[model samples]
Each structure stands twice: as structure tokens, then as C-alpha cells.
Target: MTGPLITDWSAVSPYGIGRAAFEEGFRSGRTTSVPLENEDWLVGERADTEACLVPGFVIKEVLGKKGTRAMDRVTGLVVTTVGRLLDTTGGPLPSEDPDEDTALVLGTTHGSHKSMVDITRDTLTDEKPYYINTAHIPNAIGNASAGMCAIWYGLKGPNATIAAGRNSGIATLNYGRRLLATGRARTVLCGAAEEYTTDRSWLEWHTRGADETGTVLGEGCAMVQLRAPAADGRGDDDALAEVLGVSSGITGPDGVAAGLETVVGNALRRAGIGREEVWAVSASAPAGEAGRQELKALDALFGDLDPLTLGRPGQIGDTGAATSAFQVVATLTAAQDSARAAGRVAVLTSVDRDGALGCALLRMR
Candidate 1:
């Protein structure tokens, strides 16, 4: 069966806010990393002092003062990104009611590590153990960002948040496809968001442990509006692309290349497309050995195909859970610019540290 169609999308990224900014930055081929000037984002003296941050993204300033007193960075990014997407569709805003058949799915490593850590710290350091701030309690949960998006936008359909590290975006797309296939909803806002925070920076520093070139963490959100296939087969005229198939797998550290190869092959087979038909490829070029393994796998699979290869991490830094979604957006942007990219397949592959790997195929319209 044909997959769901991506009709609209948007982003609040480090290059700047909105889809136009992201597209321009991507086309210019410039890196978004800048010296970390926000002292609040610094954890320890040795923490990496550089990152990719969305410019002028203060929560209260962006979303207004009401209902944002306790909003965390991740939630703000999600809310803003989704709102921008809805605006592009010329659909109803939060002030006006949205379609009841519209659902939402957001992917992230965790809701807000900073909020969780701060809440825990407050509980321990306060005069009494229960004296922690009650306003922060909700933002500390893993599903807070996704839940807040639904509540903020008045999206009343099935809402969900997926936490699969760097592969979360692809997982989210697959989940949205399933929702449409099952008639769970008519439209699904599928996306992912990640935040740069002191606690999160420290966690990554410890996780990487002494890599000479430290991981440059970044913050942003990217979302796409997915609609169920049209009965009259006329939706393709308005679609950015058709979700062909998605496949995932798990493997040990040493099996990265083989694992990716397995998933990509499976995904293409499910899409009923030959490998040679692929016109472009997007890779989650994570840092270190895993990244090397991922590249090796892609090279082995499509080296002879000579498809256009797109890598976003070199420009946007490591966005964690939002990486895959950004990859999807990047693919769509490139496909729109190149006549050769239309009517061809594009493949996206990702690998996470915890043995998770996934691949997705999209047929550009």
C-alpha cells in the first residue's frame, strides 16, 4: 500500500527560526555552531563552550507571557515549531479550533533533562524535601513536551511522544504512518525536538568521555504534516513526498555496518523499489566510531549508485532526537530544488549509541 503523504512542514533550527531560514542556511552550506555565550547552559568548567542554538528563542518572548511561566526550552521549541507549521497550511491557529481528526507525535531523547535535574536538586537542597517548585513538576516528565503541544494547539486526537535517541524521528514517522493506516486519525503532526542544557551537556560530555573533538550539542524542532492517502489519488499534487517504508533493528557495537545494511535493504524491499532507483541519501553522521561504521555501510550499499549524499550534522551539530527529522526536511528541500530528484527515492539512515538503527525511504513528489 502507498504510505501517508507529507503535505506541509516547518522548523525552528539553529540557522534561525522557520522553514525559510533552515532552507537558506542549508543551501548556503554554512555551519550554525557558535561560541556558547549563554552561561546558564554551561555545566562545569570543562564543558564544551560551543553549540548550535536557535537565536532569540526565549520562551516567554516567543510564545507570549501567558501560560509560559514554567515552560521549558524543549517545550517552547516544539510549540513554536508546530505553530509555524500550522501557519504555513493557512489552517486554524490556537485561537481557532483545529480539526478533531488531527493528531500529534513528537520524538525526543527525554522531555527536558534540565527540568528533571533541577526539580531533583530543589527537592534535596530546599528547606524541606517537599518544598520543590510545583510548577516544574509537569515539565520534568518524559512526555511533557508532546503533551504541551497538544494542549497548546488544541489538538485533541491521539497524542504520543517517542524516545529513541537519534533514531526517534524515523520511529515517529513510522508510528504516524501506522496511525493513518489504522484510521486512527486523518492528519498527524510528526516531528522531534531536542534542547541544549547544562545537564544535557554534562551528560553528553560524560557519555563521550575524552574524545578530542567533543560533540557540539544543538537545540531545535522539525515537524511535518502527514495526511492519509486520498481516495481519488489526487493528493500527490500537493504532497512534498510519500512515505514509502521504514525499517529498524538493533545490534552490538561491532555490528553497526551490517545492522544498517540489513535495515536499509529491508526498507527498500518493503517499498518495492530497487536500490538503484534511489536519487539521494541522508545520513545521521554521528561522531566517533559509530559514525565511521554508518558511513561504511552507506558506501557499501550505494557507492556505485552515485546518488546525492546529504549530511546535516556537519552544519547543525548533533541535534540528538531531532536529527532524523531534520534529515527528512533537508531531503525535501534538496528534492524541491533539483529536477532530477523528483519522482525518485531518497533514503535516510540513523544509528544510536544504544544499539538502535533505522532506515526510511521516501518517494519524492
Candidate 2:
């Protein structure tokens, strides 16, 4: 079956808001990093990791006051990014009519970690158990951002959220693909959002060692409009790339090489293509051990082919749940640019901390 098409996309990252800034950063291979403050309290020493944060982000400017009073940063990012997608597409997904056939499916790792922690801490520290403001309760759940978008944007179709750790982008795209294939929705907004909070940085440092001085913790949101190819067999000028297929599997770190090879092979087989045909790969090979294992796997699979790769997480830092989505955005940017001839065919491969190896194949049309 023909897969969905990525008709439009928008992103809000540390580099800046909107897709233009993100694409420029990817094209130039630039890193947006700044020293994070308050790390001494958490790490007991000067924090090693730099941070990439969305500067000057104000939810009141985007959504006004009443509704955003309780909104979390993750929700704000998704809402703003999707708002941009709507603007770029000229409101293709009807916002007035609640019955319009549009879906919102998002992916994230520890989606509401910060928000949840805040409310819990409040509940405990307060003198009275009920002293905690109940308004903060809604945004503490993993699906809060997606649910908030559905309500705020009037998207009345399937509103779902997945907590697939770092493999969320792959899961979200495949979920949208299924929705299109089954005729469940006319269009789907598939994306992921993550925020860089002090708690998150501390958690990353304690658990994953992701906050080491050289490590950069990046935060952002990316969303793409996905739908079946047009009936006329032609897509709009904004069409970035055609989704071919997605493959995902689970394995331990020791088995990542073997699992990745199998996942890549399966993705290619599903796309009815071969290794040589894949001109480039947008890899999630962040720095350190994960990057090494991923490179070893790629080398073993394609030998000397050495497929052109794009967007190492070090450039954007460790984006967690939003990392893969950013990779997709980067790949689409390269594919649509005239200079990258080999960008015609590309694959997105990621290995999440949960031992999930995911791959997605795409071709510029």
C-alpha cells in the first residue's frame, strides 16, 4: 500500500521558533548551546552539560492568558508548533468544526516528567494535603499535551499520545501511517515535544549521564502533516518526502548491532528497495557509546557504501523524545534542498534507551 505523505511541517527548537530556523541550523550543522544555571544545586558541582533551550518562549503571547495559566512548557511547545503548521497549511485541518477529520498523535520519553514532579513536590511540601493547586493536575499526565491540543485547537479526530521513550518519533509516524491506511482520519498531526527543565537535566545526569559537560540537553517540538497521497498522483509544492515504511524492534545494548541490521533490512524490504538505493541516512547516533554502536552496525550492513548521514544529536544535543522527529525534519530539509543530490532517498534510524530500534524509509518526490 502507498504510505502517507508529509505535506507540511513546523518546529520549535533551541535554535529558534519555526521551521526556517531549524532547517538553517541543520543545513549549516550548527550547535545551539548555552551554559545552564542552577546545576550546582543538583549535581553538587559545576554542571558539565550545556543546554539548548527555547529562549524568549512565552505561552501568553501564543494562547493568551485564561487557558494557558496551567499549561506546561511541553504543551506550549506542541501547541505553538502545530499552530504554525496550521498557518503554513492555510488551516487545512478545520479548526472551526469540531467534527473535522484530523488526528493528533504525539510521542515522547517521560512526557510529563517535569510537570508531574512539580505537582508531587507541591503536594508534599505544602502544609495541607489539599493546599496544592488542582489546576496543575491535568498537565501532569503523559497525554496532557496531545489532549490539550485537541481541546485548544478543536481537532476532533483521534487524539493519542505514546510514551515510547526515545523511539517515539518512529512510533508516531507509523501510527499516523496506520490511521491513513485504515481511513480513520483524513489527516494526522504526528509529532513529539520535550522540555529542558532542571529536574529533567538532573534526571538525565543521574540516570543516563546525559548531562556531562560536553553533553548538551536540547528541547523542542516538531510536527508534520501526514495524509495519503493525492488522488491525482500529484502532491502540493510543499510536499517534503513520501513515507515508505517503518520498522521497529526491541533488543539489549549488546544486541543493538544485530537488531539494527535486521531492522534496517526489514525496512528496506518493506519499501521494496535495497541498501544501494538509500542515498542517505538521518541517524540518531548521538555522541558516546550509542553513536559508536550505531556506526558499527551501519558499517557492517553497507560495507563501504558509507551512506551520507545527517543530524548527529550532538549538533542539537540530546533531545530525548523529540530527537527522532528533529532528525526527520532535518532529512526532509536536506531532501528538498537542491544542493544535496544524494538526499533523494533516505532512512531515519534510532535506538532508544528502552532497547527499541526503529527505522523509517522515505524518498523525496
Candidate 3:
């Protein structure tokens, strides 16, 4: 059973815009985190003053003034990323003939907490109860970002948004593969995005509660284009990697290590691979005990192999739903240069504090 091939990809990351910038910053091994400025958005007291943000990413400034007056941060990141990817393919825009077989699937924890909170606040504080800004109403929904991506680019295929917390990336990839297998779509764009906002920051702070090592928030979007494998299983000449297998499960707080081990083992087995075959590994590595338990599970599975590990959280901070998508991108970036990496296997794993765990296997082309 050959898997779908990754034909093209793009990213709007904290490092900068486009895939090249992300690759350069990732290879340089420098952290993107910077001191937070006291902007109007950061309206209240906060414990953390540092974050990893997409540099100079204003919606209208990046995507132009038209049709962007009410765009939220997450929607802006997604639209910008998908546009960069379409540019590589020389695809038609919304004004031109659109590809009906090309679909989109995006993952997120929530759409835009800032937009939602602001809209609610206006209803409570404004002179009239119904004086809320209607322009922002669309951005308050969880599927708003994905919906805007479809309309902005004329993607008329199966459009959907998956909310799976931090494990959303792997879940999105799996869903895209199913769309290809079922003949619902010939091409699928799979990815995830997260936005940094005061509302999100405070929510995270309350969620972390007593954890001393608070995870710094980060914002970005990463997208990859997928197509069915060639008849001979070689896939496209420019294919970056082949999706081998994906597995996920829910484990309560006490069973994090055991649960992750089960999912990773299942993914490897489905891919017809052994632990020793993995050339590289990447993990979400969220801060605190959950992160430690995730590492424990991986160690129990691949401790002896000692493959190359790419750690993104320490550099990019906690990107939430985008974490696993960034992990996939990081693996692709590292495998691009090495001849030894060709035909090798890479494993990506993620665990959320609320008990979600997932693992994915990718075979380099």
C-alpha cells in the first residue's frame, strides 16, 4: 500500500516568511523568541514577557489591503502560507478557473481566541447590547481560518477543519490521506496554524497553573501539498517524502508514557518498519511533566537507536496546534541535504496535556 506523496510545501514561521527562511533559521540553530513589547493587544498583567512571533506579519501589510480589513492573525498566517504554496505550482487564483479536485484540511486548537473574546466583550461593554463588530463575527468561529483559505484561493473541494489540540497536525495529515484514498480529492493541502494573543497567553498561564517551567507561546502556520502516489510507487520526481503511517490514542495523565509507547509502536508496525530503521525523530516536547513523560515513552522505544533528534519547542516555543506540523517540516528540512537520509525513515510524535497522543512515520524520498 503506497502512501500519498508530499509534492510541495510552504510556511509562515517565527523565523520569517516562506520555506527558505524557515529552513535557514532552523539550520542555524537560533531561537526565534524575543521580548514582548507592550502593545495595545497585551492589555493585562502577564507572567511571561517573551514569545516567538512571526516577524512583521500584519494582515493587510502582508496580504494587501483588499479583503483583509477584518482578518485575524491565524487567518492571515494560513492565507499567506497557502498563497506561497500555490505560487510554487503556478496555480490559478480565485478570479481564474479553480481546481475543484484540490481540497484543504487545516488543524487548530481554536480559531482565534482574541477575536472571540473581543466580540464578547463588545456585547457587554458597548453602549448597545447588539453593538458588537459584525466584521469580526466570522473570525470568531473555529473553522474561520480554514473557510477563509478556501474562499481566498478558490479551493472548491472538500474543505474541513480539525480541532485536536496539539495532536491536530498528525490528525490533519491522516484525514488528507483518507480523502485521497477515497477519491474525494485528487490533491490535498494539509497543515495547522496557531496564533499568539493575550487571550491565548493568559489561557495557557491558567492551564499551566503551578508548573514552574511555563511554556512560552509561539505563532505560525505550515502547509504541505499531498498527492496520490504514482502507479509504480516512486511518486513525483520532486516528492519530499511518503507518508507511511499515523496512529493516535487518548491517555489520561497517569498513563502518558505507556499510552504514547502503544501509539508509536502501532504506527511503526503499520508502516512495516522496525525501531532500528528510524533515521531521525522529532517530538512536540511541550514544557512540564507531560513533556517528560513523552520523552520517557520515546526513550523506552528508541533509546538504543540514538537517531538524530530535532527539538523545535526550545527554539520556536509552544506553537500549540502547529507544533506537530512544524515537527513534520523540520524532518523534511533535515532530510533534504543528506544522501544518507534518502530512503530512510523518520518518526514524529506529539502529546497534549489533555491526554491526546499521536505518532506519524515518514519515509524520505
Better of 2 and 3 by TM-score: 3
Per-candidate Cα lDDT values, in order, are 0.87, 0.78, 0.86
Q: Write the per-residue lDDT of candidate 1 for residues 1-365, one digit (tens) a residue.
A: 66899998999999888999999988888888888765453555536688888987888778888888888999999989998998832222363665689899999998899999999999899999999989999999999988887777778889999999999999999999999989999999999999988788887887783442667888899999998778878646889999999999997555999989999999988788998789998999888777888889999999899999987543888999999999999999999888888889999999887789999899999
Of 1 and 2, which scores higher on lDDT?
A: 1
lDDT of 1 at 268: 88
User: Which pairs of residues collide in candidate 1?
Assistant: none
Which whole-number lDDT from 0 to 100 does residue 314 have in model 3?
31
Higher-TM-score candidate of 1 and 2: 1
Pick out the ten consecutive residues of candidate 3 with the lowest summed lDDT. 88-97
Per-residue lDDT of model 3, residues 1-365, tens digit only: 87998888889899989999888988887898888873445567656799898988877778887888888999999999998988832222354666699999999998998899999999999999799999999999999998888878888889999999999988889999999999999999999999998889888887784653657788899999999998886537989999998999989555989999999999998889987788888888987777888888888888888888776543788999999988988889989866767888988999998899999899998
Q: TM-scores of the models, in the given order? A: 0.95, 0.90, 0.95
Q: How many backbone clashes can be found in candidate 1?
A: 0
Model 1's alpha-carbon lDDT is 0.87
